[model samples]
Target: MEKFSTHTGIAVPLRQSNVDTDQIIPAVYLKRITKTGFDDALFASWRKNDDFVLNREPYRQGSVLVAGPDFGTGSSREHAVWALRDYGFKVVISSRFADIFRGNSGKQGLLAAQVEQSDVELIWKRIEEEPGTEVTVDLESRTVTVGSLTVPFQIDDYTRWRLTEGLDDIGLTLQHEEDISAYEARRPAWLPRTLPART
Candidate 1:
């Protein structure tokens, strides 16, 4: 999990609403347990149409996905986050997001920014009108800017801190591994033990 700071990059406008987890990465691609290769499978069905925004060359390399409301609205797969991250997206901005998807995204160090629908529309238009348009998201200031538009958003202090530090759930737990091991060692023997029956 790389630490996030101010990011300025090309914005890919995915104007469709209610983009579910399946669309983000179809179920067919879920056969693999490894998180390394899902990038190729992202928006698989949509890309097959050759008319989707992601299929367009200008937005192909974009890292910030500016999408419609209810982005990541279905399912609870953490793979959605992995697919996005592996595909080089660091932030996903939308008017709304499903609670579970948002939680999963945060755990993986992806910024799920909630901005007004109107602001989202503005970004959508900007990208369409100017394919080379660049946007910047500043996690530190909790703001997103594109052209003349600047939108302020709210993220919990802890989430923001984690993003800035690039600490995922595993990273956070690893920070206290020593203490956690010590506490576990002090546990009562009656605690359901899995240690090879003390051979």
Candidate 2:
């Protein structure tokens, strides 16, 4: 996971509500076990239409996505976040997001900023008016800025801290490596050992 202290990039406005996991990566693309290749499958069905927002030239270079309400609404698939991250979206700004999807985003080091609907609309308008305008998402300041406008967004402290430190769940657990080793050394001899077999 990458440290997400601050990101400034072109914002792509995906002006649709109730965007579910299937629409994000589609079920067909879910067969793969690896994470890197999903970029092509992100919004796979929607990209068939040449006029889709992501298919446009400047928007294709966007690293941030500003979406409508109820974003990532169906299923608890973490793949949705994978697809977004693989597609080069570091942050997604929305008025509302599915709880599971938001959690998945945090775990995957993707920033899901929840802001007021007015602010979301404003961001969409600004990006539409100026196609290549840059938007800045500052995790430390908890704000999103575009042009002269800056709006505060909400994110839980723990998630923010994890992202700031680039700590995934495994990385967090490894922080106590010495303590874990110390504890294992003191285990009873009668207890079954859990060491891996040599190949």
Question: All candidates' lDDT scores?
Answer: 0.87, 0.92
lDDT of 1 by residue, 1-199 (tens): 6788889988999888999999998988888979777898898888898888777887888889998899998788888899998998888999998999988888887899888898888888888899968899999899989888888866778888888888768766899999999998999989776776875
lDDT of 2: 0.92
My TM-score estimates for the predictions, one after another, are 0.84, 0.86
Top TM-score: which candidate number?
A: 2
The window of 10 residues in a row where model 1 has the poorest summed lDDT is 190-199
Instruction: Tell me the spans in candidate 2 whose CA falls farther than 4 Å from its real position.
Output: 171-199
Q: Could you tell me which residue pairs clash in candidate 2?
A: none
Model 2 over residues 137-176: C-alpha lDDT tens digits? 9999999999999999999999999999988698669999
